[model samples]
Target chain A: MVVATNSFPGSNGTTFSPNDILDLEKGDPLVFGAYWKKMSEVCTVVIKGWELMSYLSDAKNVCWFMLSEFGDAVRRLHHLVGNAVIQERYIVVGTGATQLSQAAIYALSSHSEAPQPINVVAAAPYYSEYPSEINVLRSKLYQWAGDAALYKKNEPYIEVVTSPNNPDGVIRQPVVKSEADGKLVYDLAYYWPHYTPITHQADHDIMIFTFSKCTGHAGSRIGWAIVKDIEVAKKMTWYVHMSSIGVSKESQTRAAKIIGVICDGYQNIGSIESELFFEYSKRILRERWEKLRKVIEQTKVLTAAKYPTFYCNFTNESSESYPGFLWLKCDESIEDCTSYLMEKLKIRARAGQRFGVGPKYARLSTIGTEDEFNELLERLSNAD
Target chain B: MVVATNSFPGSNGTTFSPNDILDLEKGDPLVFGAYWKKMSEVCTVVIKGWELMSYLSDAKNVCWFMLSEFGDAVRRLHHLVGNAVIQERYIVVGTGATQLSQAAIYALSSHSEAPQPINVVAAAPYYSEYPSEINVLRSKLYQWAGDAALYKKNEPYIEVVTSPNNPDGVIRQPVVKSEADGKLVYDLAYYWPHYTPITHQADHDIMIFTFSKCTGHAGSRIGWAIVKDIEVAKKMTWYVHMSSIGVSKESQTRAAKIIGVICDGYQNIGSIESELFFEYSKRILRERWEKLRKVIEQTKVLTAAKYPTFYCNFTNESSESYPGFLWLKCDESIEDCTSYLMEKLKIRARAGQRFGVGPKYARLSTIGTEDEFNELLERLSNAD
Candidate 1:
């Protein structure tokens, strides 16, 4: 117990120091710090050095590397909130959704004996990392074949559908109208009730989720793939095994504890428990969106993206979508929105070119620290 | 603190149950559980939900995902033990040594402009998984070329040198003779004082170490590369980011705590901090190897691998190598030792065929639970 004293950091929430740069280029999810800090007492986890020592979690399961606790937590979370369907699906855990996505790419294309790598395509303005992420391997099995919306051929391919997508937060389905049936890897990262309306339970063949976006625990580096096919699940597990051996058990244990707390908080709504994770995050994100929209209206030099209203099955209420990242179009006078903001306003935003679009559009993360968001608004209002 | 009660699983250490089957095929490292259990009080880690909120650890470091605490611990341990060159080296963390190895392959082969995948070679009787591990990527930049010792060409290639090698615990170095310069990825997984003598501070260009093998924390899923070249470190970092974004912060935090405990125990040798890690583990491994050799003598049907004696710089004492695995050769009458052990004696051992050797030899993991090892010895001595 004395040895644990040094490690048991006081549950006063994340100790954050303000940075000079109000950079919102990446959705780093430091904004989730405040919420977790509020519930810090209930969110802290204690692990022993000798606990969970084995590399294999459950040998009987198809995904032998995934912890039984984590698998249960994921299934329970999805079941609690009407998100992805979990029954009869194999839960294969990975380091993160990035690894799972790559695994999906590998698993889908591995069946083909063709010499050429299978084409991997996503819609225009996809997650900026997709192209380079896939190309990083330079695998002979697959290659990034550009935007699916522009792909003219009907040849077999791997289609990535980022519903309640990354850049724009617009609800989307597959746009690839290929006659040949291609495999689908659903990037349902933002499909949580906090971000968008869960119109229907995601019944996709392969759906990936991350603890970072779902519970604001990006540092945990835990994610899972709800794979329908047993062989694909096994292959994905093989990919993870070949890559990282498996996800960290410490991370999985922490994830399991956090998810349990979130679920318990919801179930014990009238009790001594604190705010539900989804409700707390949704309120913060909604407020951030409103403030950004007001700043955009005042500036009249930038255009904030608009979202369609939809009824959520989880909340059972009509609301506009609140995306984690803000996609803004530049005014006609500005040639490059990202550079203009960086140079003139001292705000850092990811340029549109990285997302397979022109420089006229740029992205700023709404899920930054409160101070950073406020600074962003101040800088936007002062824009010339 | 009320929330902490549930997550604070008591550090009584590694609740292990003896299994029906004695599986000695894999080097899972559950043997370290008992040592940790002995130091359970000082071995537990407590983490708050809001702590380590961001995805990045240190933005300035080449390995942005690596915690500064972990980096410091690594440097201190290597410095204390005199096993590696710590100065001017860049540390890149991965999920495990498996991922780091893949990253090393990518880093070494990234600049090759050749249309064909670069050859990856290891000597015969090499690590069993090397061939398939490299081939799994099927990357255009690299391919498994097999047997570095027998490559009869002058072509550029990537060579892997696993010192204190996996199946056989023998210290090794680059064996290839080529006119054109080739790159080396030194897998120093078993180079610790427990397995072999620290002949000299390993000054290999790209050296990798794993927490699983070093500290016996495989479930933590943390491994690092001590890369001499800045470019290679950066490229490995890029590969990690593209694959898994980064290693888990919780895993790093726990590793930092455990490594700190180990170092502190050694420094405060006269105090009541319990046994030093290396001292404890080395004693256990030596006893296991001795017991195994005695059992082999009792059987008279198998010959145990004989290692040369040397003085360890860390221990400052004369000792013969105590391998984590038992490499044994069956009698010439037996065609396949693996099948003979499994079918007749009910002992599971990895056949030499997987290691690119004939089936006369087999490997049994010495790094398993005490009961498993006892059972292995019992099964071996009972061999007819």
Candidate 2:
């Protein structure tokens, strides 16, 4: 069997001529046949097109509940938390959660009377792309000739944090309260129904959600924010109208339909099938983590970080937690873990420094099936 | 049957309940029972006790492209486009066309080395929401404590012009060249393979495209952009990553699939049945436009911008061009034509002032089917 390399190579050296079209099996999930199949099943009363808009437009009663299906889904998602609430008075949807995040920062930073520049802070060993998100914000400023900067300790400004953070997958709850108290902009991208339920103590801050991660339908590209404050929601809506013309109406519709399936006991074959997929992934990841833990302990070549309990390192601690990542810190001398892994082990993993972590460590996602994970681990072991 | 109202009045008449669900179509588009009636049709491959993540991990390729049948279709699309050369060097894709537009602006405006703030200028009587797009950019500056006023010009710094523009349906192919010189951004939101090609003389500053207008699959929010400069592309990529995590993998795959089916001649369906949908939409649109044109001429209530011969708008006084938009100027004393249309006739059209056109003029769309178009004209006649 030919092994797939983890690199995007400049030239194809493999004789196998990868990406050759092969006969496809009808049952393949990758085929996205399932959605079509599910569509066929739900086409009965469920197939009503554009009912949400009509419902909203026709409502002669309280306007709070007349949201389109997608809007309803968002409302339902907010309701799932029980602590959260929705309506024109309390909530508004954005093109994506990203729009809301950027808008929230803009609103806080741009308010006429802010005493200082709006400083943005995320817990170290957090999502590496936070900087890039800020970069987009900063780039906007650059166009406008605005001055923005990253968050620094001792600086009085807003802070934003991502829980179950990317790259490291660390769950940062209550620990962020210090920043939250400072009226910092917080991004709880993953604190949702299916993900870890960190019942938020505060309500009126910026919280981000996406159907992609929680619902497993990444292609829909739908994300929203739950702002407890109505004013913030209104401002966010303004930003959205200016930015992307609003989210894809169709995507919102699809997300709303899928949310309906999930809420109604997830009756459709798609959600049921999706549940199975996640279980399998978790089982495989758990197993891989067990093996990975063993390898790290046995090899003793390098250890993991303790704080954040993630696959990434932040404070140079020696123990690590697996939120779904194996953040391994190899010898400190290694400048580029990406090149080393590709050149020596033929193992593909993310270089840590890209994420603000030191270059000594690397991040490997255990996102594959157990078999694939085992095979990859086997390859790594063989290389070692 | 309930008459569709623009806004629903709640019981007390203070709040608005939505009353236009049918018009918006916010839920599942499948139109169940009408299309997919059976469970077997919906239930193709049961993923057997796995969750989405599990299925994702265990899937053969662990790539969404390799997972679903629709995913398969999208994979084909990616391969098709990925294999092609864009501007001779780069291959581009976006969450949808809108994201690319916003991203391109971010890259171009931020990277300019000039001391002057970047200016965003759009042609007069353009998309109603160009100001909002500018707002998003302005908000970015606010986030950074930057002043966005630097970019504003009596003639906007970055000019946004559309061919076959919305509200008017004026196909301004050759005429757009006047604004395409150094200070403009082109919104080719409506440009497609079948429509008038505007890119022939397209200047290389920035351009945007969307699939909803072209593909008839607005629900599947897939759009893309092509940038001539690589540096701009890189910066756009950074912002995109922070936006929606590179769009939806599933949607991308499906988009790819749909494109493949089109290119390969859609299988599992006949050419004639397939031909009906396309033929019907076009026929209906043509019929509507003819009726609309007749009514406008007969009413003589307002004048539309001239439609250009060879898609060129003539500004030379002797030019006999009439564009598609019914750009009406209805007595300048009437400050807002949009409000006047709503109050007097219950007709809804955008205020021309929003597009930098002075008030008392409104922009109307000719996108509806012929029957709808005639109905709109009849309603206007009755209201008048």
Candidate 3:
């Protein structure tokens, strides 16, 4: 049997083979599938046909579609991890961070029918998907105004700040400090201790998080936001309701179970029966980062992104960042780094140009299956 | 036990009470919960945390998030029911029909950059949420042009045709005609044999359906669109991809199991053990509509929308329309019937003005829990 009681290695029977074409372009987070697959033996969910059949969950709240159990579980997890502030904040759930960010833009811009659409900006080397996601429908409420650092408009703007940023592991802060009123949306998808050290609990006007990055349940398509203002939350809820009616209650119920189990595991820490989720995920990500760095050192063909050490309050230890993605720049001789890797090494990766960077840079995912990661290391080692 | 081997009556443990301020404003669809709760004994779903961990399901398909099992089950159920043509169609999955209708508009308007946004038209007394949904984001791609019957323009437009339409249960066809080209999106949420008589196989350019209307699994938030043109399907897929990343695999998996079970039961028809889904659901809805009509007859204060009986190809019988909502127009004495009902009768319903109709009409949901439906009937019976 491929299954093991405690820990298993190099025997994930479900994922694709290392011999198959490695798609490191997207941060799929399937690397943690082995951990979750093992955890399922101890934690399981059985939903009957009649369970969670209604469209409404809690009618009293602004986000009426959100189940109380799921809401409680979200608060419990945030309280347990000390990642984000839960007190006096409204929780709005979305299909994913992709949708929630759009919801944030809608919420921020929906109220005022300004003469011109509000400019939405993210700093250069921002998440590559921001532009496509914002401009998806040609929304007249907000338009993608590229590069927050360069945005000099004295008009109201919404800036999305992705911490422990995508493509690169650098922790970020909002850069567009204009005289005009600006609303900030923090994309804290990577604010968990597994990928980076929890320096502080995030407290912002609107902060977004995803279950995919936290629990490796990407297929669930569940993401949530913590909003300080009720009106903003309501606007976001209305946007979501008009767009998709509401979030999936099946995903919400299942999410409640998953997050509840996660909190329970940590609360029972130090017991032999307890199995830690972050500990397993962090170890895997840490090892992969080490291997990639060593391969880059040996090959001398690429420059890996560097990060400063941080004291993680949760772990009470200092550690370097292990981003969900590996941002690499070609060593001066190469151009269009994404094309070179895809053509020469057969490893698919996203070009940095998509993130408002030069063609010499590319971003590769660190959270794919183990075989794919191993194959990436092998290819990188032989690059020279 | 609230569990019956063959049949049970009036002992539902779930849902709200008749005495608890009935909310019939939205189509909640909890009446089918009684049937599903019983059917769950025969069909159960157990999903593990690790299974379906990857974001990608089938990378080859336009809708990569759609599981092959779900696609197959959808095709099989449609084939068995003979309500829709599944061949030469590309099935694109969304959060629900709410999202897919938006996707259809986007798909039709995305490639073209007109000086002015295209007018999206739906006939009067359409789904109450149509205008709000189309103008949700004040999208630059399309704008809501109310009353398709009145639209007289040579410019390109997108007309939504909802058959067995919401608010009013009359069968619908495209109302707008023009010299310029126009795209059609069919909202076939009520094209099932249980809700209305499926007169013929619906073969449209783009047809959207929902699991909530079909199987009373509203919480699953799963909807699919069958498109004749591959390019339009691709465009719709792109819109969904940027919006929600993709539909929930958890919902899709459960939908596959639920629909698969329904198909299996039908294939085993004539056996003593076999129990039909549509027959069970149709019977419950038929009884509710009959009871509601009786109550309306007792109280001449309101007039209900009329419909013509049709021969159902799937059920092989003639039946009157059992709409998911009750569209009622108050007598000449009453103005703003929704306000009168909410304030005087203590019943909540959506006003007709929301559906591009007059203040005298209001739409109440007929698919709420039995307790709520019964209370509505009792209250109406008491109305003078």
Q: For all the predictions, what are the DockQ values?
A: 0.50, 0.20, 0.56
| Top-lDDT candidate index | 3
lDDT of 3 by residue, A1-384 (tens): 121111122335434343455677888887777777767755467888788777887877899889888899999999988989999999999998998999999999987768788999999899998999888778888989999999998999999999989879789999997999899999999999999999999999999999989988888899999999999999999989998988998788888888988888888843326348877778888898898888998876888977899998887789998999989899777878998887777788899899998999999988877766777888888786
Query: Which docking band does candidate 2 fall into?
Result: incorrect
Clashes of each: 0, 88, 0
Candidate 3 chain A lDDT trough over 10 residues, lowest sum: A1-10
Which run of 10 residues does model 1 chain A get worst, by summed lDDT?
A1-10
iRMSD values, candidates in order: 5.0, 9.3, 4.6
lDDT of 3 at B126: 85
Model 2 chain A weakest 10-residue run by lDDT = A21-30
Q: How well is candidate 3 docked (DockQ)?
A: 0.56
Of the candidates shown, which would achieve the greatest DockQ relative to the real structure?
Answer: 3
Q: Per-residue lDDT tens digits of candidate 2, residues B231-285?
A: 7657666556566545543344444544454445324342323332222333434
Candidate 1 B-chain TM-score:
0.93
In candidate 1, residue A344 scores what lDDT?
A: 82
Which rank order by DockQ, best down to worst?
3, 1, 2
Q: Supply candidate 3's per-residue lDDT for B81.
A: 93
lDDT of 1 at B177: 90
Q: How much is A16 displaced in model 3, in angstroms?
A: 9.7
Better of 1 and 3 by DockQ: 3
